[model samples]
Target chain A: MTTMPETVVPDTGPADVPPVPSGGVRWALVDGWTLTRRAVAHWVRDPAPVVFSLVFGVLIVLMFGYLFGGAMRVPDGGEYREFLMPGMFTMTMLFGVGHTAQAVTADLDRGVIDRFRAMPMSSAAVLIGRAVADLLLSAVSLAVMVGVGLLVGWAATGSAGEFAAAIGLILLLRFALSWVGVYLGLVLTGPSAVFGAQTLEFPVAFLSSALVATGTMPAWLGVIADWNPLSSTATATRDLFGNPGVGGEAWVTQNAVLMAVVWPVALLLVFFPLSVHAFRGLRG
Target chain B: MGASGDAVVVAGLRKRYGGKNGGGLDGVDLVVPHGTVCGLLGPNGAGKTTTVRILATLLRFDSGRALVAGFDVAERPDQVRARIGLVGQNPAVDEVLSGRRNLVLFGRLHHLGAAAARARAGDLLDRFGLSDAADKPVKHYSGGMRRRLDLAASMILSPAVLFLDEPTVGLDPRGRAEVWQAVRELVGRGTTVLLTTQHLDEADQLATRIALLDTGKVVAEGAPGELKARLGGDRVEFVVRDRSRVADAARAVARLGTAEPTADPDDRRVGVPVAAGATALVEAVRLLDAAGVAVDDLALRRPTLDEVFLHLTGRPADRVEVRK
Candidate 1:
């Protein structure tokens, strides 16, 4: 306190000593887990969003499966509930984009992302943690939707191995969409803007074969629906579960399993890098 | 790497956002020596936050040399991050997590072990007076408590330098006082802090040295008293009973100081900067009485930082002032 701060020119002290350096993939993994715990803590503190997600999925299934089952027509003439279950599963994965974008943008608006960037932790930690957390929650909602489907007399007549494969494909789409959400979150400005981005999910889900067969639609509309990534996943899952509404002549629908794998893989390839680039460009 | 003893050294720093909102630095230079509180005082949109962000390694500047804690911000940002903590204008803590949990969470991110992080969180909760509400979610904490929690989080690693970008922007009086006290405590522990504030009095109260930043560049830099002294040592002002006598009073007071006296006819006030203190005030009073000027009010006071800022930047720092 006695010495003039500008004129002191003192020797190096403890404050000048830097902390031990952190590096490599190991640190990134550790930091990612730490941030994942942060997301889990938020879920523990406020479970409303998680519960709402589950209830919403079940509500959609009930409204489509039972309410319109008799009136709705399956392409191959089967039970409407059976046709609706796989579409509902694919819809669950598609809706995850909204959640991912909202969470990312909310953190950005609140300055939490800036704080994470300022820390000495690995840069990839924030996005990785977000993806993992969203996937975990998505899995929970998927299971609940599956249970609701079973309650409505929807069954997977395929082998258990095929059933697991269907689940994997659904999650793969979700995982790819999470990156898309992350990119959208990093770019969108405010809550209203994020809401606007989330609203786009409705058109995407409805236009695809998530609720009805593309065969019943107009020819042009059917062509668009068959090419939709959501339709590909839904069609592939229907094939795996041995459910109804599997009739389609288009190349994408005919090779549904291959398209299911290609679509999410393509989405990941495009959006994963895009999300990272957007996150880094935030400083600029 | 920096050979200088300064905690932060920024020279010729320039950044352009290339948009309608052009709030970026042109050519700014600043030097904050180790273990001192340097207040970057400015009005809104003066690039204070930009400078702090660049120095904190959270922003990229166009071209400049910025070194924090002996590491260049551009070349060795990771090293700078290892040695610095930042409390942005917004409270960045997790809203759903408790204050203690938030601190512990930050500690783990800083790479502290589980037990170490918990112990550090406990210590910070006690130090920041957040123990009573440690278990409660941060969303439940009041504005002051949240700001305090933010301060506590920034201190988790006890970094060499701390960048505070308007730490008390929207806080109430009590909240502002609490933040000021916490900042003073940080300085007492020998932490070098570069604090940006829109309040001139805040700079006066907390800064060892104050840098007047305006329109993206530092217009003036010195100790608070030195800055006040630069506007001339002291001022003796008198409000006359009759507006007609304002000039008469000004003329009488003119002979007492080296500078010419300024008379405000609307307010009937005459003021002049003076080198001497009580004797100059007494001398002006006797001269005014001899000149038949009836005085309504008068006082001899040192120039406030607001006046100093007004003189340097051609504008007041802020319209509001805190009474000394």
Candidate 2:
């Protein structure tokens, strides 16, 4: 047999060439937008979770407004439906944490997350996309629940500007809570841990004044409720909806809107890094 | 050894989990030249996947240096990631979404525009022979179909370097051939492929060079022909009809060949290794016939990758345990 000379091929090709970029952050943003859009498309196809979350929020409002509204008196002069609307909004945000974990955990189990990690996109984009998609779904759920509440005798006496402020607060809270879900979804080992992480929402919601006024509760429990983050959001949402304020010291000083933003910001600050760290650890 | 430039260079790569006692990667060193398919051959727990993960920037190595396409894996992971496409052992396709949607999703993540992503998705689907199933949810596809789509997903960006971690482990023979064809096509297009596989034939068929890893270390590395040549000569075996004629057959075979004949007492079979050529077999048949021993069956076979693996690893390939 004739032996042909082996040709030595070049190791570096035009494909190995790197793009010249002035800023890495610009590439990250571009990649992040793509990831966000992909997540949105995923939500569009499988919308049951989104619908379930919204309907669940509406049921909670219905049960509380007509069944428990008369039994519990609002310190402010407004119908129970109006008093509970803000709390229902907070519940909507809280309910989203579970769905976020479920979606993320499913992705992890399916190896989709690992595939993304191997890509050239910004590492932070994965979590950011998840948060954005969940935030949008939560906003839609809030709008639907509010519309349903209005049909069930809930009325907002606040001006259009105040209504906007309440909606903004709801969005901010959801954005922050989405990060919490993203963090938990990455850190938790499996689906069971996701369920366990969701169990925290019940105590957090009940400990706050979302369902009742802190004044009527025992002094010790009232102290806990006053410090609860959800209570701060509920108080701020109530004021924006034009409901009777809890009055002096208890109402004005609560500053729920500011606290609502702070809680999520703090959560994102701590958990965002934690989630990234966990994702980095996934390789091990 | 030739000092070939490293398309993929890894040195002293070490990774451990939990503690020192825990199972993880050990110090692994690999050098893959450009435009070559280097097969990382090993059984389970050989740390082949871990090495690939580090090279792909999906996992960090605890120590040692890893450079892919001239960028440090740990320090400049994004740059390394930009150069590589990883098709892992498991199918990573989104089952709820259609195959077309899955491709689009990956394309978007690669930062391709909407129109470009759609175009690439269609091209990849057609290339992998999945165009018919593109609109169906991945859950509706068979295992082989899903694997093909998963591979297509990795190729969306047309990366310069590709890492395939057991890409055809569970595929049927037909599916395996299709994947092999796709890989050969990719290589023909000038993509450098670093693949890990348990199948010896796969390595022999596709890899320009094979690295046999055992217990997280390279026991042998060479071209398939070189490794097989090192294992010695061809194998010749034949069965005898009468159990009483086994020794007579062995003695007769020993007369024609300098090598000793090994007789299997239970089956009355004899086997011997001989130098390359049919002359040794012809001489053995003549001697056996002269001794009046009837042969039940006779066959001459060349060294297979399985034999090379057994010689290097000291255990059969099927005995190795793979982690799910």
Which candidate's TM-score is highest?
A: 1
How well is each residue in B196-289 modelled by candidate 2, as lDDT tens digits? Answer: 9989899999999998877777778888888887777665788999999988888887754437878996898888777854988888788888
For every model shown, what is its TM-score relative to the native structure?
A: 0.93, 0.91
lDDT of 1 by residue, B221-246 (tens): 99999999999889899899998888
Model 2: interface root-mean-square deviation in Å: 8.3
For candidate 1, what is the DockQ? 0.39
Colliding residue pairs in candidate 1: none
Model 2 chain B worst lDDT run, 10 consecutive residues = B16-25
Report how far residue A165 has shifted in candidate 2, in Å. Answer: 0.4
Best by DockQ: 1
Reference-based lDDT, each prediction: 0.86, 0.78
